[model samples]
Target: MGFAVAIVMCALLIASTTESQHNEAILRARIVTLTAENQRNGVALHARLAACEGGPADLARSRAASALLTPEQRAQHLAANGPQGFDVCARMESADRAVLETLK
Candidate 1:
């Protein structure tokens, strides 16, 4: 009866180890799937941000906003804020004009 009890305990131990290993494998697979999904979402978000940055609507809005400021005001704002301010369209147009002047 002692031998039988030992054998039963051994069987239970083996079953528990196998179940633990299976659960670990399942968790690893789930982690891999989640990581891949997270990477895909990050890439999609970056692409959307890139599209929005230079999209036509964004450009039009920038132009409309810049039109509210005269060229001299745009220049003064850029001189003060160093081109990263709300005068991005003005900066872009100034750069374009510079390029055109160079070409001429």
Candidate 2:
């Protein structure tokens, strides 16, 4: 039963990650249309790719981005990572919770 719960957590993580990926791709594409800077582009892309660990990835991505960016680039990346990212991430989290509840 313990192993079963681990498997379920992994599955839910992957599923929610996929859904969030879809939204991130759409949001990134939309934002890119407004302005295109490959530094922030890479930041956004890398963050989405590393979105598996939830908040930790967000922190790591931000730190990694800071290492590779100027202050202005960091500002753009931070500003860009607002409403769209949160909306989808929150949805993913909600979906994951729903799956766990259903499992119970």
Candidate 3:
């Protein structure tokens, strides 16, 4: 009986770990997709701004998008990408910060 219970417990543990890994894989894939989209957006915005075509509407949209990231997410992004990650975070943070400053 004890051995049967131990086997059951081990199976449950393995199942749980497999489920967790599967969920993690899905999340990682999502992150990769989002990151690529964000990079493309950044490039587009940069081009628009360089051409002096980005206006208040662009800024407002950027601010709104930037606000989507929580402070914890911001920290995690910076931590994960090291110094290079700061560039993207800085852009988002600054856009959000500008909006906050205007309200103040």
Candidate 4:
């Protein structure tokens, strides 16, 4: 009887651990999705704001802000929206890299 109870307890522990891990993975995936969605929304909002201003200065400001994104992010943005969309990000990367080199 004791051995049977021990086996049952062990099985329950394993099942609970598996469930916890699954839950954690689901939450992690959700966080990643939400973060990406928010980043995309911010980028879109910047473009909209620039359009609303209807001037070169606003467009330039929007381009400068795009440079703040990481290279990977720039690549992803370009891939999704095409080369024209990320022109400013790509253009600024070299200058940013040069400054970083000077700082180093």
Q: Report per-prediction Cα RMSD to one decimal.
A: 16.6, 20.4, 14.2, 10.6
Q: Give a tens-digit lDDT track for model 1, residues 1-104.
A: 99999999999999999999999999999999989987996676444323323345456664566567754554554455443333555555577569769978
Cα lDDT, all candidates: 0.63, 0.64, 0.63, 0.64
Question: lDDT by residue for model 4 over 1-104, one digit each (tens)?
Answer: 99999999999999999999999999999999989987996687455333332246455763676668764554555556543424555455566568769978
Candidate 1 lDDT score relative to the true structure: 0.63
Q: Write the per-residue lDDT of candidate 2 for residues 10-34, one digit (tens) a residue.
A: 9999999999999999999988875
So what's the TM-score on candidate 3? 0.49
Give the runs in model 3 whose Cα sits over 4 Å from its true position.
53-104
Best first by TM-score, ranked: 1, 3, 4, 2
Report backbone clashes per prediction: 0, 0, 0, 0
- Model 1: what TM-score? 0.50
**Higher-lDDT candidate among 2 and 3?**
2
Candidate 4 clashing pairs, residues 3+ apart or interchain: none
TM-score of each: 0.50, 0.32, 0.49, 0.48
Give the C-alpha miss distance for residue 26 in model 1, angstroms: 1.3
